[model samples]
Target: MGVHHHKIGGGKLLIAIVLNLILTVVQIVGGIISGSLALLSDALHNFSDVSALTISHVAHTLSSKKATVKETFGYKRAEIIAALFNASVLIAIGIYLIYESFVRFYDPQPVVSVWVVGLGMLGVIVNGGSIWLLEAEAKGNMNIRAAYLHLLGDTLTSVAVVAGGAAMYFWHIYWIDPLISIAIALYLIYASLSLVKESTGVLMEFVPEDLDVEEIAEAVAREPDIKNIHHLHIWRINDREVFLQAHLDFEQNLSLQEVTRRIEKIEKMLKHRFGISHAVLQPEFMRDDEKDLIKGES
Candidate 1:
């Protein structure tokens, strides 16, 4: 079932890539003819989407590979790395657009509204279609979400360019072109920064943002011998996998078999409650150690 789902996702991404490539070519030609900064910015945005989607498709493939002794974690983190790289490039593109928009704003060149409006409509349709294709996969997958957000931003900016183009056509408002480009640039930067931060967090092994240590402690307490759970650590292996480790202070020394049973229960609870795929728990009997739930930064 999982493999089938991944295959569907990869196929959809390829379709999106092709659509964006076509839109990029059309918009580049339209922007040149129209001398519209907004159309050009949208073209640049679509170009980034092509690159981002390609990276996501590759990473998605790598993440499906089986684990081995040489790489116990497999390639689960490939998606996160791809997301970080894609988002960083998006930000760079946004920054470039802002600079270009300002220069165009000051110069205030005449724009050909007919080409701008026609191709701007095409941009909206193409980007919107790609956004829909990736929407379901984006829900739980950060790498795919990065690509989806790019398409989302593209569709919105294309709408703005179309509106600006109409105004230019009806009222000869050339300044609206660069103004819309600036808005498009700002939106891309704003949308991409959060994705970049999230990808960075996973790669840095920061604690999973939504994890609750107290909930884990409660699970540990299910075993009567466990006095407390401390020295806790929780981090992500990927979007779908989390890892946890902690010390469980016992009321007294227990049999090895009994300890195994208790730990198994705790592991099950953690898995169901927090989606933790793996855990390491050390059992201790009044051992000398820092008994805090957390030691420091982990």
Candidate 2:
């Protein structure tokens, strides 16, 4: 029926956004003064995280709107769109950081070790707090998942910066800074690509990966008075909810009341067998038509 809102409060997200913005500015300035590319990269990632969280918060609000004639689905897909945008941004930032890290390798700059270490440790604390705040909501929502990934990336990058700073300070290994940046960028890319693919699937209305249309049709045909099932379609509303639609052929022409009862039975079967949250069915009697399990493109 309806989407369930997580127990998370807008106040918690607002707190996270404020913290990230303040720390991002601090890190950027510190990166410039300290000449730390790793620190600068972490700051950039933190900035992206801030942007992602703001988009998610707005989408979460929009998703609560009711459906209308012009927008039959209302703003339900807003969160999915936000998730796609956030994932795309993460991938772009990751690529830029990787390229920058490679360039830095050729001309490694000497960073002030104390500044990098101090800012990095502060980053870890700040990002860790933000992660805690969004952890619960992220589990069931793709938009929140993108935001969570950003914070998790930032936390990991902060740790990397600290490690690189320590290595450079003790052993004078300046190359470690770019090395850590490269590693963080690669990891971010790897993690965010999955989100991009999943969000894209939803936007494209692709069938859920776990569902088998043939199996569902066979199961529905098992009900008495049902001749066959065809024109089956399934897709996700978001990460948690699934929507299914299909046409059913019956052995006999039934009254409106009997048809309604059969429809309810089919809906219950779909929900129990496939975790389908919503279903639409069209009943037919001895209609001559194609009965393909999946409708082929004309």
Candidate 3:
């Protein structure tokens, strides 16, 4: 399933890159000819998307490589790094746009062509198609979702640029160009901040947001032969791979095999309910109660 998903995602990203490259060329020419700052901003925005998509594609490919002796976790963190890099680029672009918009606001420029506005509308359509293509694979992956959000924002920005251009054509309100650029900058900032938060959570190895540690402990404690679960740890190695480690104390006379079965059941339950695919269970008999499962305690 992972392999299939990787292939599909890679293919979609390639298509997006090709489409965005074409749009970038068109927008750059149109922006120059039409004297529309919004169109130029949108073109720069697409350029950022191209860079982000390239990073995501390379990281996804690297992540599929087998683990080596030195890096036993393989290259799973590559995707997270890619996400961070993309978000940083987004922040930079947002700030740059904000500055340029301020300049354009002071001295508004003429917008020459409604035909270029039509082309901007076509860009919105293309960006929307890219968003839909990436949406399905975005559910289980943070990196892919970030990329998708970038594309989604670009699609909306394209729409605004087209609208602003049309307005300028009829009303000659050239300031709308700068206003639209400012709006795009604000949207990019919001989206990039969100991406940073999510990516940081994963990198810090925080537990999955949907999981409740207390509830998990209670579930294990409820087992017939189990007395307690302690030193429980739950964290994600990446977006889809969650890791869990805990000590399980069993009642007297519960055979090892019985205890194993109970723990396995819990593992299966965690996998099904919480999307945790990796788990490490350490079994302890009642006699070992005084032993600390978590090392380095005072």
Candidate 3, after superposition: displacement of residue 21 in Å? 1.1
Ranking by lDDT: 2, 1, 3
Candidate that would win on lDDT:
2
lDDT (Cα, 0-100) at 247 in candidate 3:
83
Tens-place lDDT per residue, model 1, 80-144, is 99999998998999899889989988999999998888998999999998988999999999999
- Minimum summed lDDT over a 10-residue window in model 2 is located at 1-10
- Best model per TM-score: 2
lDDT of each: 0.89, 0.90, 0.84
Write out the backbone clash pairs for model 1. none
The Cα RMSD in angstroms, rounded to one decimal, for candidate 2 relative to the true structure is: 1.8
Error of 1 at 167 (Å): 0.5
How does residue 17 of candidate 1 score in lDDT?
A: 95
Rank the models by TM-score, top first.
2, 1, 3
lDDT for position 59 in model 1: 94
Once fitted onto the true fold, the runs of candidate 2 whose alpha carbons sit more than 4 angstroms away are: 1-9
